[model samples]
Target: MTMEFGPDDQIDYDGPVTPYRQLAEILRARIARGDWAPNRAIPSEARLVQEYGPARTTVRRAIKVLVEEGVLFVVPQRGTFVAERSSEDR
Candidate 1:
């Protein structure tokens, strides 16, 4: 289920897939492509909103999905970041 998405990919708001899930896939693609390095913080929610034209809640939902999949993690006050992958994961 690996989809190739580029950095300039735009969201299909009217498509069958939910906006949040589309965003999650886009972010996952970016991470897989090394747009964000391991342990590096992703852009803030506000930035994602600006870039993706999704509401804050939508962005949060996307991030939550990534976190649940172990693709990302969050710090209490810092920010969300790309999770470090172990050898087994690679």
Candidate 2:
């Protein structure tokens, strides 16, 4: 199944892979493809759970990895978002 990481890196996951990594890959692909522009609001953990059918902790772990990698950022209440990092930052 093809997953589309939309403008905000939200995905329609349909793979047998581990959900958290799948989720991370979706975000990575979106950034690589420029589907998600820099500094855009990414889907929240709750939104991701709904989309990926994963546990909250799993989603949070995926997001945390992205944040650590400079692929995403978390703002209190505002939610996670795509970070505007240059290629060198990756």
Candidate 3:
């Protein structure tokens, strides 16, 4: 499947990219496009699962990837937020 997401909300279940990876890419793009501002929460894991139809583990994995890449940070019970603005985003 030669699929490429183009700033869209739908996830291609039959595409080559795994659901978790696709979700990660989608979120990174969203952040870059300023859909959610720095230090602001994006969406809850349950919300993501409902929106993207992925498993909780998949959503968590995608979140983990972003956290590792410094695009997002978790605040215990509060939830996940976009990373603080940084020169790296420049």
Candidate 4:
């Protein structure tokens, strides 16, 4: 059960983990690796679906997890952005 992730990691559909969880881990790694700066918007849901070959629902679910974990935030029509680090995260 290796759950570790890092920048440049790709989703392995053959692995034990579900695709949505893999996507969440990948997104987390991307954020930690500075793929997108805090408060910067990541790619849109449609783009993510096209890039990762996941269903839109799966992508949304992964984004929801990051949002709940404070790693990302959504601005309705604007799109999802990386969250500002709290004092604790710093």
TM-score of structure candidate 1: 0.90
Query: Which ranges of candidate 3 are over 4 A from the true structure?
Result: 1-4
Highest lDDT model number: 4
Q: Which number leads on TM-score? A: 4
lDDT of 2 by residue, 1-90 (tens): 655444355434555656676678776776777766777887677877887677899888888888998888988878787888787766
How well does candidate 4 match the true structure in TM-score terms?
Answer: 0.92
Candidate 3 local distance difference test against the native: 0.88
**Residue range 35-78, candidate 3, lDDT tens digits:** 99998998999999998899999999999999999999999989
Preferred candidate (lDDT higher): 2 or 3 = 3
lDDT of every predicted structure (CA atoms): 0.91, 0.74, 0.88, 0.91
lDDT order of candidates, best first? 4, 1, 3, 2
Across 1-90, the per-residue lDDT of candidate 4 in tens digits comes to 878766577778898988888999999889988999999999999999988899999999999999999999999999999999999897
The sequence of per-residue lDDT tens digits that candidate 1 reaches over residues 12-72 is 8887778888899899889878899999999999999999999999999999999999999
- Give the TM-score (vs. native) of candidate 3: 0.88
Backbone clashes for every candidate come to: 0, 0, 0, 0
Candidate 2 TM-score to native: 0.69
Better of 2 and 4 by lDDT: 4
